[model samples]
Target chain A: MNGIGAAMRDAAEGVDVRAGFTGDVLRGGRRRQVRRRNGIALALAAVVGVLGFGAGMAMRDVPPVSDERLLAATKGDLADDREVLLTATVAWRAELTPSWTRDRGVTELRGEPHVYWASTTPVGDAAVVMQEGKVREQWRTLVGLVARDPADGFPKVVGTTNPEDPTAGTESFQFGPGDRTFLVVDPGIPVYASPNATRNPAGVVRRTWHEVPVVDGVGVWTAPDGVAPSTVRLVTSIGPPISDIPAERLLTTRPASAYLRSGVHAKRNGAPAYDTRMWNNTSRKQLRVGPDGPAPSPDSDLFQALEDAHMTDIGPPGNTGTWCVYGTSGTGGGLLVGEYADGDEPSTLFALLFRADGTLDRVQRGPAVDFGSPLPVRVRLPDGQGWVVASSQYLGIAYRTSDPGDWQEAQTGSQAALLPDAAVQVRVGSGTGEVVVDLPR
Target chain B: MAVHAAEEDFEEFVVLRSQSLLRTAFLLCGGDRGAAEDLLQEVLERMFVRWRRIKGPPEPYARAALANASANRWRRRSRKPEADWELAGTPSVCGHEEQVVDQDAVLRALAELPPKMRAVLVLRYFDDLTELQTAAALGCGVGTVKSQTSRGLARMRELVVEVTR
Candidate 1:
């Protein structure tokens, strides 16, 4: 057996092979199935309730209910009906989508529409109006009606209106003219017209519209052309968007200055760099880098040198860089090398030679390499020593030392060298600078 | 009656194969017996739900579910640590006594690898599945399995050397 396979087999030898399970697996399984079935059933029931409530609101008239009355009705006697409100709000929002009225010849509106009011009339008719933001990229006022569903519980969009135009201010077919209860929602904040607003096929023009804040929150209702004044009703309440936090703030929390680096320090240092490689030949008990250099142990002072050279912490999110370590055979110490770069900034390379005594031998920062050409940087060090090459253009490459046949191919990004005694070499493209260190055995 | 018969057959399969399946789970959970039991029970419950529809043997599906669940849990629990790449403090060499190659030391080393890599090792070694079978179980291509095996074994070797040194 191979060394790894044999080692793993030996390790698993003492693990308890007996399955001493006392819990009832069958009962547990059956209980889980029951829970799943219950969840699906509950979801379907809620959908039906919402649909029934919407249909009732459209067909009948409820007593003129104030905001407090509506909230109290929905909350029932529960102390915490916030979850119910949120769920109902989500279902109402789902019904505001364009597809909700796609078959009715209404296009789905862009931007999230907040549902401010949803209630059933005393006689069981359902009525809801969703305040949508600017339409067609124009800062024009648009409101959508959540019409009663023809079949399923999903709300259909019976119609939408441009509130600014008296000729197009209201859609009358869905709701009959009567003494119906009205829930007036005026988002006191100013609304702007979209700069690129275009007219829809329904002949509603997108015009710039904004509302001046009124003290009583009441506004005059401009009935659609030919509608009787007695049938038109107006109510007013200042209801801001549900949450105070901006949508953009919730989506991205990255700091503005996180990637800020001083312009003066960002320039690349023109230096010759080389693509380098390293490997340990298990049969020969020798560590080799390129054609001759030996692999370094982890306790060497090279770590200190890299730190002194200011080339540490050069991996990932902050910079496109990679740091990798491979265990050396015979010695318990590891071989560590890292390379990192910021765009247009000088790339730095660091390497450390570690001994069994916990002391590190740091490699001095080598001469800078000229950019543009793929320069070759080679270091011939004695056994138990190492080096690093860095450049602005160091093409991040990784090599597998465990498989001899796989050494020719390179893996992108930085990778760990896992084989302690496999012959391997890595070719690193040097674009900025290279550092080399040789520790005395 | 037919449904009852199917449930009985499923129960029989669990009774006969639970020991071997638990061994695979134990290794996958880094040798934690409790976590292994929980993972095994969850896998069995899911398998029981679709027992009738499952064609062929159920072992592969169970193993695949175990791997996916372990990986998802690891992702959810671990926040990205700061990108500090430097090895902190002095690097200690393992004591020479550990060079004797203890089984516990090897298992501990195996436990330290990432979940996907560990799963690959357990599936390939403990389950004794081939590259093709491992790929099918993991819902990935054979090339991914090959690369993961190579990388996993390499990392395992490194840990072993550190422990044994």
Candidate 2:
């Protein structure tokens, strides 16, 4: 009669044990054992077939195809210029079963083969539905470098054209080093460009405009050479313009008072749009992000990172998002913040700062408060830095920056304008409060 | 004839021990009666397949199989323990009100523990197995059993405090 043992014994009492359960167990066990045996027999049969075929192959005449030739033939037109980045084939079947309500429960069932062809190009990717080796539906579009699938080893395309009517189009694709190239295809679609105000030092382009092609279905434009990718503020618009006038002008022409506002317009697709919504919501609510002290859970991502570094029991109890912040001194670290839970109860908000070597620098805890729909908080720290703080009622904030070493907390109740240099884009009111930043080019 | 003899022996073992085994299964499943029954059935079936070779007492083998099966089910389903225990419903806190409440808290805490840790506690306490016996049953060393018990009890104590608060 000890602590946990006694409690466990008391808890184990009063469980009802049913009769005749043994027969059920015996039946189920025999079924599983039989299935396993059958599976092994099938595998052995397959091995025998392979071995027999290998021995008989020398007596027969069969043409051998080299891997190079097979790959070359598969890569029809783009074989010479672009390497085979990745190829994926999808096979499907559509079945229809006709059932009658009057006489028969089911009458007939039919199925047809469905296949699709997709390839990722060096410039852009194309996906087309093929029927008898003919492209039935094709959509080719320019994708942003950020949207690329890391597994594909090539940049993935962003928007897709109406597949039923395969349109040939040319749009801008940003390659390395702010190199802008207009991708021209056979069938073209409308393209619009929004100039970046931060990068355009002269502030030359105040408005977004539709670029009329020099030639039909073809357009070429380069970033006024030497603009860095970070400084370049161009986003290609493949779909119809959101407004009658271009979006860039709409964003730039807004009053400074409105620019100082914290919230953005909620879009039709639930995305936060800067120009569409009036910045009306400004209620500064504080949420508990982590425990009062350092108590990292073994299951949390921060703990896993610490464990990977062979440093245990160093941080908070809950996993919060972190991003690398770089400084001019080439020194940087990660800023992590979130709510800490002890078992099912979340008690406090915590912000942990880690040094360049993945060691703890400083930790701060805020009072626990019930969080409402997370509104984007744009804070300007005391040292003239800006950050867009987004909170996940469960996971905490997604704070990311390029140079984090010099970051310092702003005075309580600081306005948004004083910390203007750092612009972290976040979608507010979204349950997760996701951070929207460009992928590093 | 041998198959018949083995089947008879397994049936007799079940008739004699199923009640006690079911109680252990019930605790292993965090008071989930349906899950306990299913777990018991699976363990029995596994035992049935190898019953002829099972010499001496079958209780240890049965207990080990029950622990391992519960662990495997948790792994395969990846179901949250909190939700599972909630579905099991709160036990009636009528007769020995305070003791019953404490036991309920202990059950909930046990449910939240990792599978291996939970199994160690179940075998060591609910089944009244010695540390050495628990180690042999779980196929681990005595040190592992010791550490698991320590960690499991500490987490349970923390969870009890949290629930009470």
What DockQ does each listed candidate score?
0.14, 0.24
DockQ-based class of model 1: incorrect
**Candidate with the greatest lDDT versus the true structure:** 2
* C-alpha RMSD values across all candidates: 30.4, 25.1
Evaluate model 2: give its lDDT.
Answer: 0.44
- lDDT tens per residue, model 2, A296-389: 2322354344333322211112233232111211124434534332212223334445555656654434333223434322322223323324
CA error at residue A346 for candidate 1, angstroms: 98
- Give the Å error, residue A414, model 1: 99
- iRMS of each prediction: 13.7, 11.1
Model 1 off-target regions past 4 Å?
A1-6, A14-22, A47-441, B79-101
Assess the local accuracy of residue B164 in candidate 2 as a C-alpha lDDT between 0 and 100.
59
> Model 2, which residues run further than 4 Å from truth?
A1-3, A37-441, B92-94
Give lDDT: candidate 2, residue A167.
18
